[model samples]
Target chain A: MSLTNDRIKQRLIEKFGEPVSGFEELYGLLSFEAPKEMNLKILQFLFDDDELKFRFLTDLCAVNYPDDKGRELAVVYHLHNLVDNIRLRFKVFTNVQEPDVFTASKLFSSANWMERETYDFFGVNFIGHPNLKRILNVDEMDYFPLRKEYPLEDQTRIDKDDAMFGRGGTIV
Target chain B: MSEHQHHIKLPEGSIEKQTTTLNLGPTHPATHGVFQNILELDGERIVSSEQTVGYIHRAFEKLAERRPLYQITPITDRLNYCSSPLNNMGWHITCEKLLNIQTPKRVDYLRVIIMELARIADHLICNSIVGVDAGAFTGFVYVMEYRELIYEIYEEVCGSRLTTNIGRIGGFERNFSNTAFEKLEKFLREYPKVLKEFENLFTRNRIFMDRLVGTGAISAERALNYGFTGPNLRAAGVDYDVRVHAPYSSYQDFDFIVPVGNTGDNYDRFLVRNEEMWQSLSIIEQAYRKVQEFKGADAEVFHANVPEYYLPEKKEVYTKMEALIWHFKIIMGETAIPKGEVYNAVEGANGELGFYLISDGGRTPYRLHFRRPCFIYYQAYGELTKGAMLSDAIITMSSLNLIAGELDA
Candidate 1:
């Protein structure tokens, strides 16, 4: 028999300890939002700790949670460690006032791009990042394309003479 | 001070040079998409690189949300334009999985032939583009000719060349035309000559080998960490291929070797892709035989409730009230697809092309997330490009095969 989802949940609780406003599982994934202070330690536990060598960051994408009562932007990290072939997910909430999450670049090199992509797309600053810059969208633009409030303008809608779509490059 | 570890291995207390950022492609042919890569250079080498997108963003995900389950088929064609049939099949099969519709044995075999054919087409482009980026343009022309031959077969069935919306919900919308097999047979017979010709162009050529053999190297460990899949993963020496590991569609019936490279370098990527194309050809040959063996005059594939979405045949609409009613619903795209979510993946040319479709019991898909191989492969570009010769950068990027629609979407 394969490792059931319940067995995986029990394993996470056993490792993390009795719940104290932390940890939830959904859709075959165990997730929790940790405070910025203990974020690094918690991640180390997940990646380096004997039980969970969550080696693969299968997807480290950010999801904007605008209506989450109090939170402004939430950074969602999805991981899958093939050692056990189990998937894990976690989120770090960043409100408007403090939009920084401790960088995981030190833990996994791939996180460098993942973190930069999140920062580039969601404006969730990754503190302690060695080199962070805009990726995938035009640098001249001030707004992030993935942000909900940002206008989803097609190329035709913008003036053809505009720099981004200009024959020379971004029309501005 | 070599400074090439793929990950951030910056010197302690590194100073950010008052670097001027140059945006490449948002017009640069080399950026491969409508991607604007903001590169800050300390002289010629990059200090930092950032990629910005949406310039070419058609927002296929948003587009899928508006169209019916079957309507989204063509949207996937744009994702990896190199092999539209594979994308279409991947999207449709994902729907099939959610609907739990078992395609007839004949339908499975038909899909295998088409997907494998697309695979050969995809690898040829990838390998030839790598050759082009290395300044050897002839190889590109050679592979592209074969790609055209594949498209000719595509035209025979779907009547379109590049964007062949060749799949329906449960199976193919139509049968493989006899004309398609005739073209395919001729192409297969001569593809070896062309493949051998391309082999002469690069495999033993001293100039091509020097540029690619050890340049822009990645390890299986690092590639795995980066979530690399498909040819890129194979190039890194991981024998894990989705087609073999998790056999979906009728992949289990086929026997094929997953070619991998010892050193994950540009040259190895080229070699792996070259071998994979040959394997794809063999798979196509075997599948073509099976396709011919099928005695189906009936539609080998059943569709999602056609009454609501697909246009009734002219005769059916003229005669049957049920089909006519269904025809109106289909034209308006008012029919509901099964209410569920599924992530169906196929071994696409680039890698495992997975489609995650969520239906809210509506005509259109609620959310469709393409597990784009190019997007996943693009994650390692920053690492691969670092410290490589500036000329090698173009070759490395092309080998990465970052299709814009998939990347931006």
Candidate 2:
């Protein structure tokens, strides 16, 4: 039988019940979230299970929700089971202060640089990541640039007038 | 003092540092684009290597957060400049998925034609560059003519060639001109012979085989673990193609074989890309026949009828009030997006170019992530080149098809 979303959900609930929550399907893609600490366990279950062989780590990235108080950083993983040709999105949220999730680099070699990239942008420190440093940014940089705290434009710059550039002016 | 010993005394620390450290690039011509590989060498063999990318990092994901839907198309173009039309189509498809827009069949066929042409151009360049790296420049020079011919078709369809922001959200900005069809027919008529000649030059050549065979070989197990996709993964013997697996943009309607190779070496990658070009040609021909099956008014359909997202025609904007309103609204980025997350991928020349979009019912995407395949390919470079000959490393890099623009995006 082909692996459907319901079977995957049932398998997850049977293995690690209650901790895995917020299962929803959007545009035919199965997406759900779990507590940050249980990320590796869930990922391992998904990878090792004979029925649910979601081995391929298609993509890994982090999203920042500034207003979401306790859960400020969401680390999202897109896993694919090539045999069944199905994909699912798994997410784990961590507070921005201590944004640490277990690294999947040991399981999937692709996660090394992806975790570095996630660390570079959103400052999500993957726990026990070997050589977890910035992949796409300068090493000397102090702050994560992709966070909502950092605006695209420098607010303090005085080189140009904001009024002339269509900011703080009447609607055109 | 003895005459030979007294001439010069060697530095003690210099001899202590046995292995030579070589910086292969961030600008070296053989490395092709801006990629820096710090290799520790034991004579001519690479002992260990660390790769440094991001010299051309432009923070495209950060830039996408502020831009509206249509403006991001040009941004996607720079990701894989070799196949900008594919990236443009992928972005458009992602937006369409989020917006619940259904493009017409003619539009799908038109997209397939453009995409397959881009694929041919990309593969020919990669294969010929592999030849150039292996001391054969004739094939590179020979295939450049056909690439220019493909560019001429792109020019006919879109106003620009490289970095072509070709299509609107729903479909192409305009219907295919008659001259574009003529150019397509011209390309279809002439490219196969040139490709065959190009393939003959390197496929059985003793020198090319010696240089590429068994160099940079990775097992299918390791390749998948390293997130290899597109031709690179297919070359490693796993037949996981996004077009065949996911079937987006009406790819299911077309018939084409996904080529695979056993050893996952440079030679296999070259052969896989070469076979894919033929498959792309066949797909384009089938799509062209399907396109011609439509007549008169049905053939005239180009862009989908979604005025909320698709830009209005200039002539219609001048005459029609609704068109004028939509033109202003779309241009000003006033349209609200549906709150949803959509991950849409297309078979990019390099790999599966996926767009992960999340909207908060805002004009701009709340968060957008581009699953750049070149970036993934590059992370595995150190592993691919370990203990290989220094010259073989160059061949491995070229065979992997790492575009600096896409890699550092």
TM-score between candidate 1 and the true structure:
0.80
Error of 1 at B200 (Å): 2.6
Model 1 chain A poorest 10 in a row by lDDT? A160-169
TM-scores of all candidate predictions against the true structure: 0.80, 0.96
lDDT of 2 by residue, A42-97 (tens): 99999999999999999999999988998999999999999999999999999999
Can you give the lDDT of residue B354 in candidate 2?
A: 91
Give me the TM-scores for chain A across all models, comma-separated: 0.75, 0.90
lDDT for each candidate structure: 0.72, 0.92
TM-score of chain B of each: 0.89, 0.97
